[model samples]
Target: MKAKERRNNIKNLLINSSNPIKGQELAEKLGVTRQVIVKDIALLRAEGKKIIATPEGYLVTKNQENLITKIIAVSHNVEDIQDELETVIKFGGIVKDVVVEHSVYGEIKAMIMIKSLYDVHNFMKKINKGKGEPLLVLTGGIHLHTICADNDEIMDNILSELKNKKYLIY
Candidate 1:
């Protein structure tokens, strides 16, 4: 298929799917390398597509009318990453992204899109296998997460849980 045609197919697939689609799967369907799919995703994003790359795969952002977003500041050792995530998910919060403040770069952020325990497990596995430092390492475990939930009560519960676990910065 032509590049434009392939990209259009990818967009349609993402739009119609409820879950993120892996690049390898897309590549297999299109008879191209995973790298090509990645490039196509980038190109699509460059053209203003709302393609979000999560640990699970690529997904188009959904518009949920009642969803509320909040930025929470957290501080903890790397070992507590799982616990922190679980606390949020347990309180019906979806982790949207992680943001860290860098002395040189000011602020850096990455999409996490962790909504369930399964996503947490996969994210932890990817981190361990790559052995790469998390963005929180830049600031002594101090980072921010943008969390989404159904209402303010859920966000408050998530904050309370993190505070009880000594993970909330304030």
Candidate 2:
């Protein structure tokens, strides 16, 4: 395929992807190296594509009407993280990202990619196995999570549950 055609194809792939598309996959489809695909994505972004780079891959944001995002402050012991995530999902919210204030790095954000209890459990397990500390613990059990939902009612319910569980800091 010509370079222009390849770039166009990559754009189409990214636009249709609900989640991040791996560079390797793109490269394989275009008979090029992953680096080339990365460059192509960069060029596409430079041309005004709303693509978000994530740890897992690159994803194009969905153009939906009435998309709302809010950050909720939450706190919990290591053991309660799962419960917190479950509550968020139960209330129809996606725990989009986690933010922590680092002493030297300032505020650090990580994409959690959690929308279900299964994701929560696996994330906790990985952290446990790695013996890594939660960012909230570093900040004295205070952390913020960016969440997305259809409306404010979901957030209200999540806040209520977090409060009941003593996960919401005063």
- Tens digits of per-residue lDDT for model 2 on 129-149? 875777777887778998777
Where does candidate 1 stray beyond 4 Å?
Answer: none
- C-alpha RMSD for every candidate: 2.0, 2.8
What lDDT tens digits, residue by residue, belong to model 1 across residues 94-140? 99999998989888998999889989998899788875788888999
> Among these predicted structures, which one has the highest lDDT?
1
Q: Which ten residues in a row have the lowest lDDT in candidate 1?
A: 61-70
Off by over 4 Å in 2: 2-4, 128-134
Which residue pairs in model 2 clash with each other?
20-58
lDDT of 2 at 13: 91
* Candidate with the greatest TM-score versus the true structure: 1
